[model samples]
Target chain A: MSNTTHPDTSRSSDESAHAEVTVPRSPELEVEQEAALRLWVILSRAHAAIASHAHADVARSGLTLAEFAILEVLYHRGPMLLGEVQRRILVSSGGITFLVDRLTAKGLVERRNCDKDRRARYAALTPPGEALVAELFPAHADAITQAMRGLAADDQQVVAEMLRSLGLHAAAKPLP
Target chain B: MSNTTHPDTSRSSDESAHAEVTVPRSPELEVEQEAALRLWVILSRAHAAIASHAHADVARSGLTLAEFAILEVLYHRGPMLLGEVQRRILVSSGGITFLVDRLTAKGLVERRNCDKDRRARYAALTPPGEALVAELFPAHADAITQAMRGLAADDQQVVAEMLRSLGLHAAAKPLP
Candidate 1:
């Protein structure tokens, strides 16, 4: 799994090594490649299936997925920097400004200037927004629970731990 | 995991049951809800991270992610119906017609009438397309392997099995 394992074929860790002539097409290499490829396809399917259910629930609240995500983060964590909200959302429907603008226009969210840092700004839910999410959050959580009910509780725990490790590793940049 | 367990709060099998006055929000319910939500965030991060690596490799071959997906399917599974291609890919970039049109324009793929049914069209790789994929498939596989190197080989196998169960379960319709 390390660069040292394929030092000859893979010259750079950040870049995919091209078709090297001396690359040993070992049976083990083939198995690993297929395993990884299959894992991705399976992962994508699971994400899409669960997301469809989650999105349906969000839509009923008249909020786009990204908008609900913003409110949810604020709902749980209190006021947050706009940049932080963007980072928390895996898929930003549009730029943070555009999404925040739409929310502000809807009167569900308002922006505040940072007293300590002139350049920093925060997004906080309006009272109406707070009440709305408070009313809706439990049901929203219920929607996700239903969506994932396919897995046994023990299975859910295992998948959660496995994914956390996988995500942290994938997010790290290769040593330059 | 069955409807019989929460018949009060959740009424319909397919829909999220709203708050029922008599429903008990057991500590187990709270634990399950939080577990599912955390799993989703972790899953998305893992997907986005691994995809970025896979995508960078596809980009190097001068193909958009969806376009490469189509080519890869044909490359691995042979000529398949356009609709089948669309279904196989969890995320389609655009309408199947539009993607096929783009690939057809590049002369990497060609459409042929299905001998069995005049209404059915098959997308087969042209000589250049086949040649291109043949050249790149190995390295592309290597890219995925590298991206997944975060997990031990055994962990990848475990994840793949877990996702298969989760995806199949999610895809099944809830009995009305």
Candidate 2:
């Protein structure tokens, strides 16, 4: 993804033809802007690299990334409302429905009606689903560990804190 | 999107039925695994939060994310070989062709034959494209800075370093 946080101020070969319109920024803001842009690029590249490898691992196990995510959530959280599952995994409602249908057809997941709310439905793993996730979870964890093996413990800790801050900040509503 | 690095070692509410098969990992390895898993989740969430906002900003400017990316690359890199553009932006060759064609249709980007390689093509911005990016880029940069405004300067610097390390490490070939 193009991290649009910094204007490309570096001298381009076509510099003569391309003119700048914005007034000059203070040197401090310029440095900060450049840093923001660089950080965005690194963050994006790392996420893509790690995600591609992890997705490939899940794909090799005969499950799509979505399926693996749903199963993993069910495995860890026990039974959950379809809506809750959708929110937690960040899948769309339509996507969750489609995946749940496939999982249901595969006999790995079953739906249960909510006692109090007619419109609410819960999804629980079937015996096969439970067994599959139980079998698969370790290897999945190993893949993650292997993907991140390059970073040492201290670096991982620092990354976790930084990312938590960034994620929460970005996820919040933009300042008015 | 599922950061599958950590096994849910937490006692499940339905623990009796769900039993583990994998051998217990060492305490140190388990801690490391959890940290890796946590980092992956944070990284993904942060990227999603930031990218969604950035994409939306671009969308509001009457361009798709891919279109904006192509324009940004051309603006920064001057004329680039079609293949190089595809590689740099992580777009597939077919997708790049389609985007370049659309850009050409829109009169924002133009194609040129490679002087050295007859079969090769290049994509460069037209005067309008140049003017549009120059007009659009500062707001885009502001959006990025705003998206990441939660972190202080020191925190941003630390994040940049940590993310650089993580991105470089994750992007390298997996350890044997």
Candidate 3:
């Protein structure tokens, strides 16, 4: 949105002199920088669009996005360690604990001690939870399908692969 | 992750009979549903990875992500209305107001009354804000570049195009 060229504009005379000798202009790096910035904007906008619609769908089912995500994961994966659920849902440990507590009170989820590991617990769906997911999963899937309908199947596949690559790459690296 | 197949496992026999007549099994729809779910997972994971790293970078610069976003937009586009800023950043009206207040208190942003429209106000960056962004933007750019380095230039371009299309499509649709 800003037309100003960056890292080059508004430099003091002294800094300019220092930069001239130290910062060698690499056209390739500049191109990469611009590309990365554009990519981030597009990626963020697209994610917001899809998430907003999916969130609305989940809300209509009388569940928060986190609630829906937890139920959906448990519905598909069966019972999982509390830690595993937290990781898969990308929620904070304390946030997951709170959500699990709420779900437990609603009779939608249950926590059970692990058989082999006495200290560990697993979060499992209740009969009601399974029923809710079975009822709502179709609509959730439909919302996603509608959001992505603009892309052809092949395009969706390509986008998914590229995103997976980017996600894995970023996840593997520590923040600098 | 749950390995359980859903909607089919927990149904009563009578409900199954009812579903058999009501819910037609279409292979085409099944494929679409699977693709959509996969895409949502991939998209969310990629967003989380990039946002986590970007948020960390912004934090080191002593700005919250929302604050940085507002400053960046103002830095690029010059002054903008409070509502426009809210739309661009996907923040609530109250959230944007609070952020602007914080920025104003920090002497980085100012609100000016529009001459033509007395009811309208613009939020513009101060010289200090400009200088901070000028100094910090390069690192922000670098952080984005590093996160996206996994994808080749061509791959990045393709992904950007696809995401743009998806975002536009989703944005155009009314929430169902």
Poorest 10 consecutive residues by lDDT, candidate 3 chain B = B1-10
Which should have the higher lDDT, number 1 or number 3?
A: 3
lDDT of 1 by residue, B1-176 (tens): 00000011212233332233335678888778767777776776777777667667777878876778778777666787876777776444355678789899999999989998888789989989878977887787787788788888789889879877876776673521
CA lDDT of every candidate: 0.70, 0.74, 0.77
lDDT of 3 by residue, A23-124 (tens): 555889877877787888778778778877887788797777788888987877678899887877778878788889999999999999999999889999
lDDT of 1 by residue, A14-115 (tens): 343223344667888877876787787777777767766667777787887678877777766678788777777654434677878998999999999999
Q: Could you give the DockQ of candidate 3?
A: 0.34
Angstrom error at residue B86, model 3:
1.8
Would you list the rank order by lDDT, best first?
3, 2, 1
Model 2 C-alpha lDDT per residue in residues B1-111, reported as the tens digit of each score? 211221123333455335543687699988888778777777777777777667767878888767887788788778989987776666667888988999999999999
State chain A's TM-score for model 2.
Answer: 0.84
**Error of model 3, residue B7, in angstroms:** 17
Candidate RMSDs in order: 9.6, 4.3, 7.0
Off by over 4 Å in 3: A1-24, B1-24
**Tens-place lDDT digits, model 3, residues B1-176:** 11111111222234231243237768888777767778888888887788777788888978887888888877766788988887777777788889999999999999999898988789999999988877887788889889998898778988989998998898788888
Q: How good is model 2 by TM-score? A: 0.86
